[model samples]
Target: MYKTKRTVFIFLILLISLIVLTACNKASSSSGDEETSKEDTKEASTEPVELTIAARAGSMADALTEVVKQYEEETGNKVNVNAMPYDNLKETVVLDVRNNSGAFDLVMIDDPWMPEFAEGELLTNLDSYFPDGLASDFVQKSAALGKVPYETGSTYAVPFIGNVQMFFYRNDLVEKYDIDAPQTWDDVLAFAETIKDEEQETFGYALRGQRGNPIVSNYLPLFWAYGGTVLDENMKPQVNTEAGVKAMEMYMKLKETGPKGVETFDSDQIATSLTQGQVAMTIAWPSWVSEVDNKENSNVVGKVNFSAVPSQESDAAAMIGNWLLGIPRTSQNTDAAAAFLEWVTSAETQKEMTILGAGAPTRVSVYEDPELVEQYRHFPAQLEALQNSVARPRTSKWSQVEDTWGMYLSQILAGQLDIQEGLDKANEELEGILAK
Candidate 1:
């Protein structure tokens, strides 16, 4: 009986040992399976994604194409770029987003168009992706263009190209005439008159006066400098104020020293006149900086200088015309699009893009990069101007308002209407527009 009891006890011990061993093995296997599941999920999240980008045609499109090539090669992703004219690109994006079509993952926008897109709820609010908000390294004014409610609301885009209006002048002439760097509109006029009289081949100034957006753009700096406001506190049109008339009169005087058909001039004419040594002074976008020094294109290489627009009643307010990149709300690849935005706007990528002769950079670091500043001599001045830039009116009806204002301003420039008459008419039309 004692032998039987000892054998039974030993059997029970073996049984207990086997049960515990099985439970340990099962727990280990379960843990391993969970880890495998997590790994699979992570891999799926990072899998290669195909994306589509809609970009403005011209140099912007070319630069983006080259950058996309590098991105695809590095990340094993595919990107199809659809480059079109500005109007067509805007229309396409609006249609796609309005229809909820997952067509364009990314789109390039002019800064002025932000209000329209934001008000329509067409863009994705990027606040979540950028929880900490935009980095301080971005030009604050340029970054503000991406925010809704004109710099106080959630971000909808990122400033991709830093294009601000810069004052360009023939430094050689300024020195020749012993003129100081212009500090006010009055000084610019005096200096311009001197240059026009002294220089036989060159006009004193060049301006964009073509009817629609061009004329309004050329006039805003002067308008704001004279304490003119496009709209009052109640959103009423103030284009016919005393300040507006004075600014228009000043604009007319500047035109007197320009080319004979200055009333019909546009960006191309303005840039060409300056680069070919035909204009002594002008306000132009940063894109023209390269041509001013390029031997192949410029006749006044190393003779031009850039600065912030001159002040009058108010301080200098360079008109900001930055191009922005945004993810469409209908984009099926939001994560991939956001990734591309962060990558492109980075200092490294912007530096690369600058080397390719892309648009002006939006990052402070890129503008201050030693190599870039050396290549683009206007970089420091450009950075200064961007930091002090001002945006156009932030209203969904800005297009209509600008169109009407331009028409009247063009008529005034063409001598078809006096300053007061044109401004009054513009204000009347603008009031009608905002009412709608």
Candidate 2:
């Protein structure tokens, strides 16, 4: 059966290759499924289609490459991967899909992005394509990201990367300064003030000051903590109100302890600022654990403790950073993608990847895997964060909403616009986007 499928897949790839689109200067995409199709044995005279698998570069990409190679070797099909710089992945996939470029056969997309892709009909739906029905093994939370709201509708993507924000702090500093681990926004403010008074060199925390995703992601926990939200349950923009104001006010307070040029700092800057001992605490992804303890890069090796991002006025709010995979409507081989996806997301593969610290699993079982637990000390805390994590609003206008918010955030952090004005302008723009 497996051989038959492989033979059929290879044949389909050949057929698609005959209708050459353009010079294939191959670039892999992130969770952007191209138009896919299927044909029978009789209509099989075309050249094989090469698949471009796109994802972020780093340990994550390296891990994916290993698995991808295994797939290629098992089948005679070639799968070329494009490992993008994290900053470029978002724009690359979105732009390509919008143009219907079909540059990427399989893309690893950010979970927040699924709404944009699915709603626009840019991605291939998994339900009608996966012949055996959707696999039951995918983790529920991760699976939920790809879900269409009504009637167990078709999923546009499947989860691959399971990421969540975790809070990290210097345990020694927490103890020495007689500071309590922050329990809420109020606690964080008080702690930052205390750190300012006691340790001039090390502020209480590091906040992403850069514009776009960085700054916005940094503020979400605070926004939720103050009971302000960008949208209500009905998906309307409501970010310029009382709760929003309170959250913005608190966000500015964080600037006190953050790096000097925080307004320009992205993930790299914030991570460098915190792990190198510039600040006492920071909210970061799990990947930071490796950076902090690498002795070669960190001065404060072996001194950090990781936990769920602290909460007050609200429980801890971790941003869920998940990636989803799915077949595209333009694909000439749904069967191949389905087989490959099932093989890739299987329990054994997830375990191997997590153990290697490649891609963390969405499955609960992998969280308790002994080797993974040993390697990643805060696995339990990470899982807790994942469970309590907040997903960005899922409307077709999210891209524009993020653009406006990101721009306003830059202005606010730069003090070019006061928090209220910036937020007010953002809300207005977001509403316009939704109304449009």
Candidate 3:
């Protein structure tokens, strides 16, 4: 009996030892599998790459930064943004690309610079990447500006900002005076006069009479709508034509109704005047439209109404001033940069961007998105204006032309030079530029 009991105890001890060893092996296998799965996930989600972007400063810069944050969070890629001043961005990017400094993998370019960059083969031709062509939802006018040949050619850039000039007015004041919305420049002048006389205001209009780009851009719509042309079909200067004289005369006439110290007003000042409800009507851009509804920045919330720019003998033509994103030919991270470019310009991202009130949409779908249109009352008009817009002349020399021409326009506006004299001088200088 003692030997049998000892044998049974040994059997029980052996059985207990086997069970413990099996359980330990199972636990170890499970943990190994879990670790392997985690490793796979980490490899899948993170690219372990870094990208640099040259972006413009101000609200546009902030907006791009927000987009980059979303990209980094999803992909675990390191992104460095270089936000340069608007005045310096072009020259800086040009130098970086010309020297292949590799400082910027991606760069934001103004539409006017597209020709120069394309001519020099400084940017990647996205045609191979977008073999099916760009998304159809992009505004045709805005997208066309991204092509090397203006309306057609290989796509080198993507329009990031859907900007076109717009007409802004105080709806309450329009109603108070019982005036119909102006359809022509003549009507605009008349409206300005009525507002000045009936309201006993010092200025009924807000004009950006500052020298250089600000004043030139503000005057072009009027110049175009009055059947004037800065250059003829032959690319020769035509600013001294009868229509040109008339347009400048009308511009001067409108200036007569603007505030004192108008010569110094830039976009910011024009925006401020309208936001404060101090101006009756102003020619504006999508960049300024966002401010009218912000309680923090504007006193004219819900009081300002927008329309396509007014016309005269010719149809209304808003000027396209879009920002574009392009990859440098020398970029080492072309694949990553292209991915980011495609991602940010997607309709989904653009809609998300609008929700954040970043910038205007380049996608028609975003523009017509019912929620967006309801929230931004100017969207329909903005879309119409974008469709009817004209781009600056597709010339590599546009910057120089604008400089010479805008200087003369400013001189005329400041009363330092005669209108005819300035026009003739601008025409001669432009001819000389085109000759080259």
True-structure RMSD, every candidate: 4.0, 14.5, 11.4
Ranking by lDDT: 1, 3, 2
- The CA root-mean-square deviation of candidate 1, after full C-alpha superposition on the true structure, stands at 4.0
Alpha carbon lDDT at 73, candidate 2: 74
Clashes per candidate, residues 3 or more apart or on different chains: 0, 21, 0
lDDT of 1 by residue, 1-436 (tens): 9999999999999999999999999999999999999999899888999999999988888888889899999898888889999879988999999999889999999998998998889999999999999899999999999998778888999999999999999899888878788889999998878877877899988879999899999999999899888988788999999989989989989998888998889999998999999999999998888888889989999999999998899888889999999999999899989988999899888888888878599999999889888888899989988987889888889999999999999999999998898899999999999999
Q: Which residue pairs clash in candidate 3?
A: none
User: Which order, best to worst by TM-score?
Assistant: 1, 3, 2
lDDT of each residue in 327-388, candidate 2, tens digit only = 65555555666667777777788877776667478777788788778878878888788877
Instruction: Indicate the worst ten consecutive residues by lDDT in candidate 3.
Output: 195-204
* Stretches > 4 Å off in candidate 2: 1-51, 73-77, 85-104, 128-139, 150-152, 178-180, 357-359
Q: Compute each candidate's TM-score over C-alphas.
A: 0.91, 0.81, 0.86
Error in Å for residue 94 of model 3: 1.5
TM-score of 1: 0.91
Error of 3 at 188 (Å): 0.5
